[model samples]
Target: MSGEQAGWALELYQRSVLKQQKFAGIQSLLGDTAGKRCLDIGADNGVVSLLLRRGGGDWSSADLAPEAVASIRSLVGGRVERIDGGPTPFADREFDLVVVVDFLEHIPDDRGFAAELGRILKPGGRLIVNVPREPRWSLVWPLRHAIGLTDQWHGHLRPGYREDSLAALLKPWFEVTAARTYCKTFSELLDTALNFGYVIKKRGQGEGGSTAKGTVVTQADWQKGGAGAMKALYPAMRAWTALDGLLPFFKGYRLIVQATRGSD
Candidate 1:
């Protein structure tokens, strides 16, 4: 059973335009998992994991970081595993679906990670990946950098992946079906500004040891009227994101890629 404070991540989800857009893109592409065995790996804050569980899958979540595992535990109860950074403990072809979220770039051996993902998935199984997309040039790069969102801060080994490059990485085990990018300039910049404020506020208090760092909300953050204020303002934030539709020319920072595992 989830603790009383699982709303920590849910609160962050409500306040984050980027996370909302990412979740929307992922849900639209990921079909029903009812009665299927699903693995959600590498979730930092585990909001998606909680949502997936609610959506009715035989869901298990895991993370390589202990901080992440504890954070996930607060949301999804006993279903999450804390794994070492190597081949996972799951049996071969054990999962009908696998969703990899935001941890690929943090890995040094992404090829091996891809291989492991393939090994755990049954043939014809679906895989969903969410990542920060690499762009040729981003106008908001300086803003993000100024806010201390560098690769190290993000725990990223590399910046991120392009669709083609990421597809090639998964080529040995799966076929890519679809790719979509979101969080365009307007929304992304807004996200960055919010993160800047969050970082500032985080400095004022002792952070949760079980919680992963970098812009995620914690139980402590839920204690005040601030969350209510943000939830009430989220609609306006969503409306401001509508400006993204006006600039189709600029690629967004977030990317979701879907693939299917093969029997080999």
Candidate 2:
């Protein structure tokens, strides 16, 4: 494929991925309980805040960074809260529902974090989670230089997990309610691409990998070869894309798990 085609393919893939990854099944499971307090970890740009508010869930947002808290507050006016220090900062049983989306892989000891999530959820409260699949698949870092996202993968300590593995972690605290694999696809020039998917897992782990943190990367001080580099990457990109189809036997794109807090 030509560089221009490769660029277009990548763009198409991104749109497909975003659509799959951002579903609000969490709100549905929360049902009419949305007006209760919600806690969304890794609230990033606070997009989920809007989702919760729209869903009729009154919730506060939490992030690991004060700067992020400030930015979110500026954007939404006192809706976001800053949690200073370490994993799992909230008091016990403080929330009705927690949502953690695509944020678990960054922490090394994910099980410990899940345990903490369980501690903070009220009895029968729900936790919604989505993370990378077991096979650890990702598009070729994608124009890293153009986007200035050097070391983008560093944030993921073990970004991939299987359904059974995830189940084992949460079984102690939550009962499995619903579980499934979900992906969204987009077609471009007769080729269909998947952007990202959720291994939809839920429970009262109160959104363990659910919160947000603050970090930044400045533009790289050097110019990327742009179209030239893409030209060179084409051969590898094609091979990688081809391999993605064949590797399902070993691991999938992600694992989805859903569980609810066990009645104590």
lDDT of 1 by residue, 10-113 (tens): 77777867777878988988798899999998777678788778779899999877767777878888878876556988999999999988878877788898
Q: Report the Cα lDDT for residue 112, model 2.
A: 76
lDDT of 2 by residue, 182-233 (tens): 3311111011111110101112323222223413110110022223443554
Regions of model 1 farther than 4 Å from truth: 6-11, 206-213, 224-226
Error of 1 at 261 (Å): 0.8
**Candidate 2 backbone overlaps, count:** 19
**TM-score of model number 2:** 0.59
Q: What C-alpha root-mean-square deviation, in Å, does candidate 1 show against the real structure?
A: 2.4
